[model samples]
Target: MLVLVICLIIFMTFVMEVGSIAFKLTGVEPSNARFQALSALTGTGFTTKDADIITKSKTRKKIAMILMVIGHIGLTVIVVFAVNLPQLISSWQLIIGTILCIVTYLFARNRVFVDKLDNQIESQLVKKLHFKKEPIEEVLLINDEYKVAEVRLETECSLINKSLASLHLTSKGILVLAVKGEDRVILTPKGKDIIRKGDTLTVYGKIKNIEEILCK
Candidate 1:
């Protein structure tokens, strides 16, 4: 029972990690992706407006479904094992489980190990799933007042054909981090660069300011 419980815990950790990676590949931020993955796996009701990110994306929805299913089954098995734990209590089993749990925790906490494992898993997932490697428009909230977001310009938008210098985005307290054009990306785009339709702009500023200046 002890061994089964320990193995289940480790398996749950792995599933969470995989879920995080899957969310990330679908353009979710790293920290939020991990949190959402864990929340879904544990059946925790940690909903926020960000939950819409998963619901709106078909890939993310599928990933969440898988995590929830596996989480339910895994939790059920763990509960069954835990119920029998008192009856089958043995000093050796307890000691071994403790050592194994500690080892697993250490392994999970090791940055180098986790990074390598994540990289390998990410690579395989991308290859098998044909996930897009390009940058996707992801918005990240820095705090209550500020946010970083990617705004994609449309053909009919007034911003198109305008140069960054003419727009004076700096005066508006908005910083353009990068400009992803149809063919390539420009990091720290120069003021002279023209805004073309279908171009994605990564910008940072106050949440309200960003919405007013770019999202419109």
Candidate 2:
């Protein structure tokens, strides 16, 4: 019975960790979904600020429901076993089991493990399970090959008064995604968007190319 309890604890930990990953793949942000998953697993209802976040989606809701059931069952079994046969297990078994449980918790919380595991899980789910999720590229655009940067227009720069169309920032391998002026922020600035001195341009593209063109 002691061994069974230990095995159940490990299994519950795994279920919770997997639930966290599933939440992320469903388009929830890492920090947010991780909390949601852990809370759901422990039957602790954290604020419902993102409640609809998990409940609206069929897949996420299913995972959350399973975690809730498993959490209640797991807690009940632990209590029943501890009360009925607390002395049956040796002290060493308790120490080792507790250590393992702690280690598993830390491992699951490590960011590196989360990222690598997410990639592997994402690949398998997409290829074999036909999992449909947002592309990672959409979530994070700045990667090894490209980056986003901000450039503040200097008063002396040649492009001070030019419109975006005339400057051809995109042609130079840089795209101006937004413009931050003294009072307002314009998203997807139009071609006729005038470049004003002191305006900050948020751009995305090859870093070196952007530096050569927009960063001038």
Candidate 3:
């Protein structure tokens, strides 16, 4: 029973990681993607707006479905094993489980380890799934004062053909983190980088300022 419990925990962790990466590949922000993946897996905390994001994307919807199914089965098994724990309780098993749990927790908390694992899993998923790599604009509220978002430039956008230096976005307290062109991504885009139509810009700033400048 103890072994089964440990196995289930590991499986669920892997599944959640996969789900998070899958959501990200579908264009969801990293933090939001992880939150949504956890919500779907545990069958909780699905706000109407958040749930709509999942339901609207076919790829995300499929990933959510898989996570939900696996989560239900895994949780059910865990419950059954938990109920039978008293009958099989042993001091040695308890000690071992505790030690294993601590080790797992430490490994998970290690940023380097987590990054390596995430990269490997993401690589495997990309190879197997061949997820569509379209540029998508996603806006997320960070707090009462700040916001972070991806704004896609359109043909009619006023910012098109203008360079970042000319727009003076930084003067308005807006920072452009990256510019996603059709073929590649430019991190920390320079002042000379021009905004082209269909390019996606990841920006961060105060809520009102971002809305005024980029939301249009």
Candidate 4:
């Protein structure tokens, strides 16, 4: 009984680790990726607006498919084991063992263990795309009418060496909220703040106009 319980715990951890790595490779941020991994492995199907990052991508969809398949298989195996357990043990000790197993399983899912194990596992995986970091939830801080986006600035763009005041981004209905450089973040930057190549610009504006301004 104890051996089976240990096996289940290991299997669950392995599944979540695979899910987390898959999410990171697809360009997801660390915290959100971990949550999505747990959601996927448990087959919770949690309603998440940010889930588009995973569900909308072809590569991420492949990971989600594998998780769903494994989740179903694990459920089936648990059901079969529960049905067959009575034949192996007939005494009241079986019931006590099951109660203890449930308690142990709950303890094994403790957040501290999960977080530590996740961090250790992630340290082994490569974090390659620093420039492609996902935007934080700054969009939610503003009113419903305004939206925020992070645009990665490339060298050789015409906007190089220009300050917000010189470019007059406000004239085009855009507001530069912040600039994230290689080592520091300039928040609510003044008009005199220069826009450097390789900086990430967090701007507020309509989706269409901002898309045109950045995607051009």
Superposed model 4: Cα runs more than 4 Å off: 48-51, 86-216
Error of 3 at 156 (Å): 26
Pairs with backbone N, CA or C atoms under 3 Å apart (clashes), candidate 1: none
Every model's TM-score? 0.67, 0.54, 0.68, 0.49
Compose the digit string of candidate 2's lDDT tens values, residues 1-216.
566687787787667767777776665665566688888888787776667666667887887888899888888988898786667888777787788778878987899987797788767777886666531212224876678665666567777899999988778887888887888899979999898987777778886676567645
Q: Model 4, 1-216: lDDT tens per residue?
A: 434544665687678776876676555554567688778777785686656666667767777778878877876776666666656655565666677678767766799986786666555544532222222223433554567876666565667798889988898888888888888899879988888877778888876666666545
User: Residue 150: error of model 1 in Å?
Assistant: 3.2
Q: Tell me how candidate 4 scores on lDDT.
A: 0.68
Q: Give the TM-score of candidate 1.
A: 0.67
> How do all the candidates rank in terms of lDDT, highest first?
1, 3, 2, 4
lDDT of 1 by residue, 1-216 (tens): 798799898999899999998888776766578999998898896677657878877888999999999999999999999999999979998898999989998998899999999999999999998875423445777998887887767566778999999999999999999998868889979999999987888998887787677756
Instruction: Score each candidate by Cα lDDT.
Output: 0.84, 0.73, 0.83, 0.68
In candidate 2 the C-alpha lDDT for residue 100 amounts to 75
RMSD of 2: 12.1
- The per-residue C-alpha lDDT of model 4 at residue 188 equals 78
Better-scoring candidate (lDDT), 1 or 4: 1
**Residue-wise C-alpha lDDT for candidate 3, range 1-216, written one tens digit per residue:** 786698798889889998998887777766688898889899998999998789877888999999999999999999899899999978888888888889889999999999999888888888887875433534676888987778666576788899999999999999999998878799979999989887788998886786677655
